[model samples]
Every structure is written in structure tokens, then in C-alpha cells.
Target: MAKTTSDLIVERLIDWGVDTIFGLPGDGVDGFFEALRTHQDKLRFVQVRHEEAAAFAAVGYAKYTGRIGVCVATSGPGGIHLLNGLYDAKCDLQPVLAITGHTFHDLIGMSYQQDVDLDKVFMDVAVFNERLMGPAHAENLVDMAIRAAYGRRGVAHITIPKDMQEWKVSDEQRSKANVPMHSADLAAPLAFRPATALLEQAAEIINKGSKVTVFVGRGALHAREEVEQLAELVGGPVVKALLGKGVLPDQSPYTTGGIGLLGTAPSVDAMNECDTLIMIGTSFPYMEFLPKPGQAKCVQIELDPTRVGLRHPVDVALTGDSKTILQALLPMLKKKDGKFLKKAQERMKDWNELLTDRGTRTDMPMKPQVVTHTLSRLLNDDAIVSADSGTIATWTARYVQMRGNMQFSLSGMLATMANGLPYSIGAAAAYPGRQVVCVVGDGGLSMLMAEIATLVKYNLNVTVIVVKNNVLGQIKWEQIVLEGNPEFGVELHPIDFAKVAEACGARGFTLERAEDAEAVLREALAHPGPSVVQAVVDPNEPPMPGKVTTDQALHFAKALLRGQKDASKIIKTLAEDQIREVV
Candidate 1:
């Protein structure tokens, strides 16, 4: 029997082991959508509100399942909407295949509706970009796209013309190309020599220096055991980046937690105290936090040669896979008894103790730390957490202890707002049986709150916990720190997020106080479908365990006095009346 080109594409996707596709269908891609309907038994199509959400869902799926997640979009605007998510996937090294429908071959260059240079636009984001000029090329392009996504651990885009989608071909005529699998093999002896020389130089520095620290990143995820072993061998502490959170267990004595603006005290102190710093699989961008050029010798190991010394001044650059370099460096390194290890371990203990005390506080109006701690406790052991950027990220990073099985997904590179809700929806769709939660801030939730409709439409069992503080907390914090006063634009008029959820066909609850939090969360989690728990918290509460300087404190006090004089007077009169009645 003859098969339509769309059928061939679906068949090829099935061959590539794709069980689900995240996307929206339109006129340009109607044929593909129709073709998907016929294969309903084998493949599940998840309809999302926007192409960007679909792309993000693909990223979530790939991150959790370690498979090539797929998303489809119509040409032009639909395809363009995918760039942000694609950039996230690309930077995070998540494997995703993006299939976009293009204008008909007959309409080529004539500016037909929804006709644009999708291949060219997607080129920078995707590891491989190709357009299907003919029906015969469809299978090969699909296979290549899948292969590129897997091998490069990034996004790949393939554009199919509407005319090509309607073409018919016999089963025998359809080409079947087997995609190549990724291998962990090293290139050659020359590749080893350069890396070996760099490793030797790094070892010499470690041997001479009494204090050395190891900083791990996402690139080191695959070589965690080796990285840990190296850390132990050197008796140095291992600090990870946000993306590298679960690569090494947080409870490990060698683990010093993450470093950056959102980093913990242990990581900062360890990094600053170390005489030599070894960076593995992380191109951490904050040069201000990194050691000065001549302060502490810096050694970096990365797979991409271009990334070497790009951010910080690298005294030694090793170009290879993390595991490969670590394996080679293991035998050459000499074990040393150093104070760096003991000092870092002690600092880690103190930092953890401080975080635990702060997080467990039973304060009125509810502390962000307490909220995150309670959420962490209530969440399923294997629940996938998608956190949006801002103060919530800082809180979650500090308090939420991720287990090995619990996956944490984030828009690391893009740091885009409104990502948490859609990302969680995608995560829930990808892993339907697992509990998926989106810990979002008020500002971020407002950005893509409409995705709640997508959740209801799909009946995805995802819980969204909106931290309704009525302001961009991170921006507010920055204003306090850098500007020395409250900014006008940081404040937001409160919205009824629970009502918004209810209107979107999902269950909703408003948390009025700290005591109401646990019960509200439980009800949301127990709901059969999507639910939003709007946690109302004090807008003026500062982040815990973070100190304000004397000058900043004085400024804050003066601002409070000037701003709340009338309110303070009313409070004082009430207190005086109560005292007089008691007397």
C-alpha cells in the first residue's frame, strides 16, 4: 500500500522511538496533524497553548527520560516561538527534535501565508538544521535530526513543506536511515597529549599548594563518580553549579553546595580560601566571584575547546570529556593531607546548620525558607520540581534538598520568566504518573499564567504553587542592596491567582496564613487534575539568613518611618487603649 509523506514521517519517528510529541497544529501542519490522528494507537500527541511551551515540555521530557524529546510547530511565527525554549535546550544539552511545517514548494519565495526561512532562523539554536525539499528526503532528514540531537545533546530542527507532506510513496520506496548512536570514545593519542599536559600542570599546582578546591558543573554529570573520586583523592571539597545540583549528593561531606549570587556560604568561603581552583564542565559566568588572574591558579576542563578560558582566566585548559580527563589525571595525582579539606568541610557543616535553623522557623506571615521547607517535605519523594528564576530560586536552591531520583528542571541559561508553569505542565505530561510541581513567583506566574488552560485542556495532573508576594521579590531585594531604596516598578497589584485557576477549569485555593499552608498544599496535590495553590505571603519580608548592612538598615528604617507614619500612629493608639483597659 502507498503511504502519504506525513505517514512516512510518523513511521520514521516511531522508528526513532518517539512515543509522544508536544506541539500545536495549524493550517500549514494540518496534514501532519491528520496523519498523527491515524497513528493514535502508537503515538500520543500533546496539544500545548504555544510552540514555546511545547519546546520547553520537550526539554523537560528529555531531561527526565534521557531520550530525544520532540515538538512540532507550523511554519513562520509558530516556528519562531520555539527559539527561547530551543536556546534553553541547547545551552543545557537536552536532546530535542523540532519538526516545523513550512510553506508549500509551489509557494517558495512567493511569500505565501506562514512562509518564512525557518531553517535559517533555527540554525543557531539547533545542532543541525535542514529543510525537506522533497518527499523522498523526509525519512533521512528526520533520522538525521534525531541523531544530531542525541550526539550533540542539543536541539535539531527539520522543516517539511506542505506540498511534500501530501506526496505519496510506496513503503518499499520510502528510505530507512538508521541514526548513529553516541559513543564515549576518545578521539586519538594527540587529543590525550594536550589534555595530559594540562592535567600534569594542574597536578603540579595541587601538589605545591596546600589548599585546592573542585568546582563541578553539568558537564561533569556523566563523570560524577570520577569527579567525586578525584575530590576524595585530593581531599578537596566539591562545589556544584545550579545545573549540577544533583550530580553529587548534597549530603556528601565533600559537597560544598553551589557558588554564585545564589550560592551558599560554604561554596563562597571555600572558593575564596582555596589557593588553586579546578573547574570541571562549568563555564560559570560571574568573573567577579572567581579568583583574580594571578590570585589563585585556575584549571578548567571542558569538552568544547571554545569554552576553555572563555569566562575566567585559565592557567591550564584540558579539552576532552570530563570522565576521560579525570581518568587520565587520576593515576598521575599524588594524595596530599591538607587543611583545605577540613576547613571546607567545617564551613559546609556550619552553613547547613544555619540553613536548617532558618528554614525551620515558625514565623508568622511565613518565611520563604519555611515555605520551601514545607513544600519539600510535602512533595513526593520522586516528584519533579520546576522552579522559576528570582528569589524563589534562591530559596529553593538553599532549602530544597534534591534526592538522586528527584529530578530538578530549570530554564538555566535563558532564565526566562513564566517558564515554571509551562515547564511543569510539560514535565507532568512527559511523566504522567510522577508528581510534578511548579514553584513560581507572582511575577513569573503572571507572565504565562494562561498556560493553566493548557493544563486543564490536557487534564495534566500538575500542581502550581504560586508564591503571591505582590512584587518581584528578587528585583525588590536588588533595589534594597544596590539602589539603597525601594523601586516603584517592583511592586505589583495583587491578583486572585486562585480565581484565575478556577476560571481555567482547574481547582484553586488561597492560603491566607502560614498555618493554612500544609492543608492547602495537601488538597491541591490530592486533586484529580491540575490545581493552583496561591500562597499569600508578606510582601515586605526580607530573605532569611541574608544580612543588611548598617547603612542599608538606616535607609530602610527612614523609608519605613516616612512611608508608614499614619499606620504606625493607628497601631500605637490601639496598643495604648488595650494597656489602659488592662490597668
Candidate 2:
């Protein structure tokens, strides 16, 4: 017997262990939805306002759960909307499968309404992209897409022709499910060990260096204990990439927070000052922040062989998983002199004091640091905090300490805004028991504020804390430092986000002053349904580097000379040790 191609898709997805699909209804996808309606218990559909949100939610699910995320959308404009979120997943190297409907095969070349070539549109973003040829290609294509996504650690896509979706699959196609694909088949390339000869060369280089620092990335999240042990053995401090921020507990003596511009003083100090830099599982770009070429030796352990030596010229490139390589190397080395570690420790201590003072200041307008630091205290051990890129990421990166079983995720390489709400929705949907919190700025929240309705519809336990600074804080500061120009197009009118949340059928709170922080946050977090807390943060607050560049100071002077507004305010922002804690 033969079954509809739509039923074949649904069944194959179930075999892939996917329980949920985020999407919107469309005429082209009616057959797929019909199949979904029939398989109510096994397959779930999450209806969202925009196709973009569906894609972002899938990205969040993949990132937070380490499972292949699935999302669906219909043809033409609906499929077009999914590109941005799919690009985010591609950039972050998360595994995702996007199933979209297309114009009927008969209408595709006829220039019929809503007929677009989805295959060509998704070519650059997807590692594997194609359309179903017939019912016979359904299971094979879907399996290949899923496998390709997990293997390459990127997005894979499929577009089903609206008419072909109704075609039947033969009984011969059904028997293929007997040899179901196992989860073990999706293991990341890092699971296997490198050659013994490669390991030996890496160990030799690591043991010879007296002043070394271990840098971790998202790949090291599962290997934190091994990373900490290796750091202890080398007498080195560990700096993190933004994606790897919560790998080592914040309180760890051997760990320093994230690197690059959004970094801590200790991480900056260690990277610039180390004689040997051991980069594990991260290909952190922005070479200026790293040790200059010929200044220090390097060793990188990356699962992808092509990515190794791509950033820095490597002395040893061990192509394997972070945990496997680190565990192997840990036994071969003796502890080095702690002189470099001591200097970093002292820097970290001083940095902590400055950060604490920054977060504790009781100013009229609540500082962004206070927003994150307060949340740090309110967070339960098992919370998943998703931060929007921009100024909010600065506060979350350096100020909040994600300890215990808590996890923190942000738009790292993509640096996109508006993902916070969708990410929280996906995270909460994936882990129904754990609490999900999103820290988003006014500009970011406004990008996808409508998604609040999605949260309310799901009745998820999500708390969105909006930082209302009324400015594009990160880009504004960058203009001053990078171009020596006063802020242009950075100012924004303040918005009462609490009101927006209320309109969407969720609990809302407004904390205008610093004193009301504790009470409002408590109320918002305790809300059973989706809640939003709007805090009016200080506009003068700035995030600078650990050591201010001469270019930065000269640029500031030039901006002031150019008759920039609030010169005095700019001076205060620069001088307030509380404001530029990272710098």
C-alpha cells in the first residue's frame, strides 16, 4: 500500500526522534499539517506569528539541548523569512533541519502566484539543500538532511512541492524504518581520539611553555572538568570565548571570563601576556585581542581539521574533541611556575572588586551591571539565561556568574538582536520544568516584541527582563572609540515594555528606580505564566576594554572637540571605574 508523501514526512521525522515542529500554517503546507493533525500524540506543532521566529526557536532548541532542531514553513515569503534565523544557526554551528513547502511543481515554472525557487534561496545557508523528487525520495532525502546537519554541524534544508506532498509512498518504502538510525550516529567528530603521534607533539609543546593560558569554546562545555584539571596542571588561567562562557564555574580559581572585546581584565591580561596559548575547541577571530604573531606559540584542538590553523599559525594542531585531547594531554605535563598565573589572579581579584562596586552603585538610573548582577542573585541553580547581543551581552558576559547547573547562550558569531525572546520560547518549550529567562535591551526586544504572544500562548514559564537604556548602547560607544565621532543615530525614545507585555496577555512589571529592583524581579520571576519586567537603565553606562587604547582616548578627545553633546556626561562615563570595568 502507498501513503501520502505528507504522511511519509511525518513518519520519517518521528523516526528521527523529533517530537516537535515550530511553524505557521499556509496553503502550501496544508497536507503536512493534515498529517500532523492525525498524529497528535507523537508529533507536536508550535504555531508562531512569523516564520522567522520558528527558525530562531529551532536554533535555540538545537543550541540549548545539543539535539538536532526541526522547523517548518511554507513557500515564497514564508520561506524567505526563515533565512536570517537559519544563518544564525549556520554561524553558530548548530544542527538544524528546515522543512518548507514550495509552489506546486506544475506552477513553479509557470510564474504562478507565490511561486519562488526555494532551493536556490537556501543554497548558501544550507550544507545540504534540495526538494523532494517523489514519494520514493522522501525517507532517503530526510535522513540525508538530518545526517548532514549533525555531521557538518550546520543547517540542512528540504522543500516539498505542494502537489507532490499528496503523492503516495509504496509499502516498500515503509520497511526501511526497521533499521532505525541511532542517536550514536549523530555523535560529533570530537568524540573520537586523535592519532597518538599527534597527541605526543601537542603534549610536548604544552609542557615546554612556562607562561601558558587555556582558552575554551562551545566545544568544551562537556569537558569543563577536564579543562579545569588541565589548567591547574599547567598553572595557567583559562579564558573563554563567549559561547564557552559558562563552561568553567565562575568561581573557579583557574578560570577567567570571555575574551575579545566583551571580556574580563584577567582574560585580556592572560592572552596578551602568555608565552603559549592553548586554544581548545574555539576558532576565536579578532586576532588583535589575541597574542600578536611571533609573540607567542600556539596549540589548537578543533574537531574540524579545516578550521585548525585558520586563526593563528599553530605550533600543534590536534584535530579531535576538546575533552579527549585535553584528557590525553593532562597526564603528560608537570605543573609550570605559577608566576604568570599569580599576575592573572591578582588582576582577576582587582577586576572582581571593580565589577562588584559597579553592580552595587545606587545611582538614580539603574546601571546595566546592576540589572545582571541582581538577576545573578535571583537565578536558581538550573536556569537557562538567553542574552540578546549588544550592550546586554556586555553586562551578562562580565557581570553575571552562571554557576551550578545554569546555562547561558547568546548570538555569538552572528551578533544578531531579537533572538532573546524566541530563544527563551524554544528553551522553555524544550525543557518544560526548568525556568527560562531572557535579558534583552530595548532595541533588541523591539525587534521581535510580537513573540511575547507566542510565549503567552504556550503559557511557558519565561521571564523577560528588558533593559531600557533608550539608546543603541554598544554601537554608540563604538562610534566614539573607533571613529572619534560623537554618537550619531544612537538615541532612542524610551518605551514602557511592561505595557507591551500586558497587551499580549502576560504579567508585566516596571522598575523605574534602583530601589525597587529586588521586589519587582522577585514578582516577575515568581509569575506562573510568561512575565516581562522593564527596568530603566542608565544611558551614560559604557562597556570598554581592560586597557584603553591610545586610539580610543584620541578618538574621545576628537569627538569632544567636534562638539559632541553631553561632553561632561561622556567624561563621567569614561572616568567612572564602575562604567568601564572591562577596560
Candidate 3:
């Protein structure tokens, strides 16, 4: 007897190790839903309110578990909604399979309700895109999509027509269509031998120079030890990008932290002062902050050839796996004396002291840096942290130091808001026993507040901390810096986030004082189920140790002078506070 195509698809998914799928059902996918109902015990389907949230949830699951996250949506509008979250998954390099339902094959170009070219729409965001042309091709297509997503570490899309849902095939034929496991291909020839030679030459230049620095990127993820060894070999300090956080231990003597708009002081200083700069595994976009090509010899090692010399001109460009390339250079590199290393270490010490002092301040209404530091100290060493975009992300990036066992997940490339709660839900679902914390700003939390229902439905024991400042704080700071005006559209009417949490059947608390933060956080962390702690912070407080150019400072000053005639003295005091904190 023949089996339905939906059953064959489910069988293939099982073979691919997908036991659960996060999605919402519609008329177009009703037949597929029925297939799921038959295999209810073997394959669980999580129903979500919106397709976007479903996709976001899959990202969290993929990051935590290192598996291909699967989500389903109906054709057209539902599929369109999945694009934003799928893009987030794609950029973060998470493996996701987005399966959507389509109209009958004969209805092509007929303008049926919800008819759209899903494969074309999702092409840019997904690594692989295809519609299952017929029942015979379903098994092979599903298998290929899964492999592409897994191997490439990106999103993949598969569109299933409604007519193909109930089509049948023999049981033996279905069993033969099982997805095959792919082995990691480590034997491929390294791409950049000539580039590697240039890197060696760059190393010689570094040894000859007084100040050398390494700016690490996401490309160096697997080669942390090699990169650290390289830094030590040449007496250079390592500065990471936001996506490259925690690649090496934060406390490593050679590590100088990240450099960007939301960067630390020592990192910015190291990059600026270096005589030779080595770019590893990063296609960093901010060319203005990079060392001028002539001032510092810039050498870049990347996997993609197009990325080489695309941003800042590279004096040397090596295209290969960071591990393979760095390993090759290790034998050729000579041990350098410690003068440069010592200077970099001293700068790092000063930076660490500055961060410690600012975090210990008692006068501020709620020092965000202090709160993040305290949370890092209080949480379990193995805990997972998911931070939303905006000021909260900036604070977390600077303050949340990750230990070996701890995992930090964020929407890095997409930089999307409202990712924290759903990400936490997905992470908790992926690792039910591990402690998961969702760090969100007031504005981001308000956008997808309904996902709190998902947490409640799953009874996920994730702790959510909302930084409540009654404004879109990051953009407000930008307005203060650039436009020299008090922010107009950034202010938000206050919402009782704790009460909302309670309404969603999760425990909730409101923290008004900084002193109460630690205890409240500890309590929430200890809760048996999902909880929300709304931390009301000062709106006017400035982010610590922020970098401002001379021109930016002038703009800020002009804005302050134009707006507050009598408050010029107060503005000057605030600006002085930022400067003092740096030293």
C-alpha cells in the first residue's frame, strides 16, 4: 500500500533528527497538520501565534542545540512574515529549515488567495531554496535542504503544494528516502597559500615593529587557541568584534576586548596605537575606525576571497580556515620579546580598573554597567544569556564576560529587537535543565510581549529581566550626540511589565532601587518557572566609557547649549563624568 507524501516528509524529518517543529497551521497546511496528528507522539508540533515568532524560536533552538531548527508557515503573507526572522537566523549562521505550504500546482499564476513565489522571496536570506515539484521529488528535496542548512550553517526553505500533501507512495520507497548524515569535510585543500606567505611576511614585519595588534572576528571562532598563540608569538594584543566576543577568555592577558561603536577603551586604544594590525576572520565594515593603510600595515586573513581588501586595503590577505592558516604560520613565527605585550597588558589593566570603578559607583539611580556586572557574578557559570538589540545589547557586550561553559546567544548580524524573549524560550526548550536569561530593553520587550504566552505554554523556566527606562534609550543617546536635541519619538509611556508577566501566568517583580537588584534577580533565577523582573533605571544616565570623536563632542556641546540655557553646567558635568570614567 502507498503512503501519503506528508507522511513521507515526516518520515524524512525524523530521519534528519527533527522530533519537533515550531509553527502555526492554516488551511493550506491542514493536510500536513493531519499527518502530524497521526505521529503526535513521535513528532510534536508547537503551535505559535505568528510565523515570525516561530522562526525566531527556531533560531534559539538551533543555537543552543546545534541542530537544524524547523518551522512552518502558510503561503504568501505567512511566508513573508517569516523572512525577517529567517534573515536573523541566516546572518547568525544558525541552521534553520523554513517549510511553507503552497497552492495547488495547477493554480500557478492564477492569483489564488495566498499565492506567491516563496522560493524567490526567500532566496537571498536562505542558503538553499526550492519548491518540491512533485511527490516523487519530496524526499530528495527535503534531504537536500536539510543538508545545505546544516553544512552551510544557514537557513533553507522548502515549499510544499497543497495537492502534494495526500499523495501516496509505498512504505519501502518511503524508508529508502531517509536523510543521510553528512560528515565534516576537513580534507579540502586550504585556499590561500600565497596569502599565507604574505601573512608570514606580515609576521616578520610585526616582529620588526614596536606595536602590533590582532583584531579578531567571527572567522576566528574555531581557532581561539591558535589566535591567542599568534598574539603571544608576536607580542600583540587581541581585540574582538561584537560577534567575536568570548572567543578567548575575557581575562586572558593577551585579550584587549572588542572595538566598535559599543566597544571598550583598551581595544580602541590598542587598535589606534598599533604599528601593525592583523585582521582575522572578520569583514569589519567600520573603515573609519580602522588604522589608516599607510600608518599601519594592515593584514587580513579571511575565508572568502571577495572580503579581502573589500573594506580597508589589506597589505596581506590570506583566504583559508583561520585554524589551518594560523597553524601553518606557527612553525615559521619566532618568539618575540615582551615589550609590546607588556605595554598592551598595562593598558588592559587600566581599562579593567576603569570598568570596575564605574560598576562600583553608588550615586546613580541604576547603573546599567553595575547591574550587568552583578548579574554576571550572580548567575550560574553555565547559564545562557540572550540579549535584545539596543542599549541592553551594548551593556551586555561590554560587561557580560563568558566563562568556558557559559553560552551567549544574540541576533548578531541582523541586530533585530524583540529577539530576547523568543530566543530565551527557544534556548530553554533546547536545553530544559540549563539556566536561561533573557535580557531585554523596555522598547524591545513591548514589541513582542505576547511571546510571553509561549513561555507560559511551554512552562519554560527562563528568567527575563527588562531594563525599564521609559524610552528608546539607545536612539535617544544618538539624538543627544548627533542632533543635539532631546529625543522626540523615543519616549515611551510606562508599562507595568511585571504585571504583564503575571497576566501571562509567569511570576513577576518590579525593582525600583539598584540595591534591590541582586536579591530580586537571585529570587527570579531561583523560580521554578518563567519570571519577569522589570528594573526601572534612570533615563538620563549615560552609557559608561563611550567613545566620542572631537566632532561628535562638539555636536553634543552645541545641542546641549542650544536646548538648555541654564543647564549647560549640568551637561558639562555629565560629559566630564564620561571622561573621568575612562581614566
On lDDT, the leading prediction is 2
Per-residue lDDT of 448-524 in model 2, one digit per residue for the tens?
88999999998989999999989998888888778988899988887788999999999999987667787889889
Q: Residue 378: error of model 3 in Å?
A: 1.1
| Candidate 1 RMSD computed on C-alpha atoms after optimal superposition onto the true structure | 6.1
Off by over 4 Å in 2: 170-190, 578-583
lDDT of each: 0.77, 0.85, 0.79
Model 3: how far is 166 from its true place, Å? 2.3
Best model per TM-score: 2
TM-score winner between 1 and 3, please give it: 3
lDDT of 3 by residue, 1-583 (tens): 5678888788788877787788888877777887889887888787777788889989988877767889999888888888888999987788899999888878967999888989888979999999876556677778888888876778999988887787765432433444433322122243454455576786676666677888887777778889889888888889888767757767888888878777777787787888888888886777777787687877777876767887777777777778888887777777778677788789888877877776656655666766777687787878988999989988788788877767776888788988888888778877889999999999999988988888888888899989898889888777766677655688899999999999999999987776777888889999999999998876766663346677666656666666733245445447546563211
Residue pairs in collision within model 2: 545-582, 545-583, 546-583
- lDDT-wise, the better of 1 and 3 is 3
**TM-score of each model, in listed order:** 0.86, 0.95, 0.90
**What order do you get sorting by TM-score, best first?**
2, 3, 1
Of 1 and 2, the candidate ahead on TM-score is 2
